[model samples]
Target: MLRDEIITVFGGSGFVGRHVVRALAKAGYRVRVATRRPHLAQDLRVMGVVGQVQLVQANLRVPASVERALEGATGVVNLVGVLNESGRQTFSRLHALGAKTIAESAAAMGIRRMVQVSAIGASATSLSRYARSKAEGEASVLAALPEATILRPSIVFGTEDSFFNRFAAMARFVPALPLFGGGKSRFQPVFAGDVGKAVLAAFERDDARGQTYELGGPGVYTYEALMRLILEAIDRKRLLLPLPWAIGKVIATVSELVGALPLMPVIITRDQLIQLQSDNVVADDAKTLADLGIHGETVEAIVPSYLERYRHHGQFHEREA
Candidate 1:
């Protein structure tokens, strides 16, 4: 049976967005993917049957475009966020302002069901601009639609994710990996698939409305431990060097400068370094994945499958006893 509800998902072409779109499609909701480039999001069409998924060009900075995206939509999902800022894509504009625009527009359209995906460390007083902007976005979404479900997930990991893939790529060439702040900061890496389920549950469950949930995995691991896990997954041994915060800051500054040059890859940003100063874990008192009836996947189960490509001989090589 086809459902009459339509869900306009902002940033539906992104990593996490793909998971959410897939879940929504499996659950029989028609998905309208609103993105800046409809041409680039053609892959999302395969997530649903022909005509079941539609793509429309929409820019959050333009209220008119945002308003148009919500036309005939019964629900909205704001998955748009930036890990790094570029020209015209600052944190304030994308995270806070864009979120507000979506919420307010949904409210005007009388669409009460909404979900906002935020980071776990989001706070008004956070030292990192990314976290602070996320907090602002959460506030704006709630203010405009008080019943909108806010999901704060820790570092999300998947096959195409930047976190594990980045280090695994680095291990391929670099002899050592730097552990910012002595690698003591902890993280509860949550799977991207589980987060998608959480979004679906939030929309279906009445208890989730107007509530904030912190999504994390079952186990917590330190920065160093995570790095070591990446190395082990790829069957490689590399030095895990402990770098002081001051030194990491200097390196990050230089990286930012070098990244400014055309064709240069950004290894790390100063703001990202600041984020590493704090633990990216769920709080003891926060509502968890279990509350939503999701059994989060472990890094050991999923990380190794994707990281296999980074191994010597690409998974054909046998481990020595």
Candidate 2:
């Protein structure tokens, strides 16, 4: 059945947003991708048939633009988030205030069906500003639309994910990878596509409303184990240097300072280091992907395929068993 409902997805041009948009298109819902630059997101139109997906200019910082984006929309999905702060894009502005704006805008437009994506380690009292902002955003969303579904996903992994892809790229040149805090912090990496499906489920299922779901993968692994998995995938060997938190903080501080320079990429920040101190796994009693009828994909099944590009010969070399 071709649904006539339209879903406005803020940040629909992003990595996770791409998956969500594709899922929405495949589900026969008209998708309006709201982004700051609609021209840059022209490729998203092909995800569906002619006129199934359209892009509109919308900046979360601008409340009027957000309201305009929700015009004639039955639901909204807030997938906009930033891992690093730059200029006016601080964690508080984008995560907390931006979310509140979207949620409030959706509510004013009589759009109740919504999904707010958050991180698993989000805590109001966390040392990391990112996590604390995420927690604040969750609160704002629920306060505005109590029936909106909130999804807190662990480190999400996919072809374009920064997590796995970052390390795999580093292994290509770096002699050794640093294990901050001995890499003991655990994570339950969830597949981006599965999270997309969960977004669709949130709209389709009645019980999903007003519920908070913790989306995670089938297995949990430590930071060290994850690094090992990346090295194994590329069939490469490298030293795993275990660094204490103090040393890691120092490195992060320098990285942040250097990152202040124009065009300089920040490898890590002190705030991100603080975030790594906490475990990013689903709570035992919390509702999960299974609760939404989604069977989370395993990292082994999906990661290796995309990681082939990082191989020495780019998938031509025979991988070790």
| TM-score of each prediction | 0.98, 0.98
Superposed by TM-score, candidate 2 places the C-alpha of residue 87 at a distance from the truth, in angstroms, of 0.8
- Clash number by candidate, in order: 0, 0
Which candidate number has the best lDDT?
2
Residues 1-321 of candidate 2: C-alpha lDDT, one tens digit per residue? 558999999989999999999999999999999999899999999999999999999998889999999999999999999999999989999999999999999999999999999989888999899999999999999999999999999999999999999899989999999999999999999999999999999999999999999999999999999999999899899999999999999999999999999998788899999989989999989999999999999999999889989999996988667
Where's the lowest-lDDT run of ten residues in candidate 1?
A: 311-320
Off by over 4 Å in 2: 319-321
Q: What digit string (tens of lDDT, one per residue) describes model 1 on residues 27-104?
A: 989999999999998999998888889999999999999999999998899999988788899999999999999999
Cα RMSD of all models vs. native, in order, equals 0.9, 1.1
lDDT of each: 0.94, 0.95
Model 2, position 209, has a per-residue lDDT of: 97
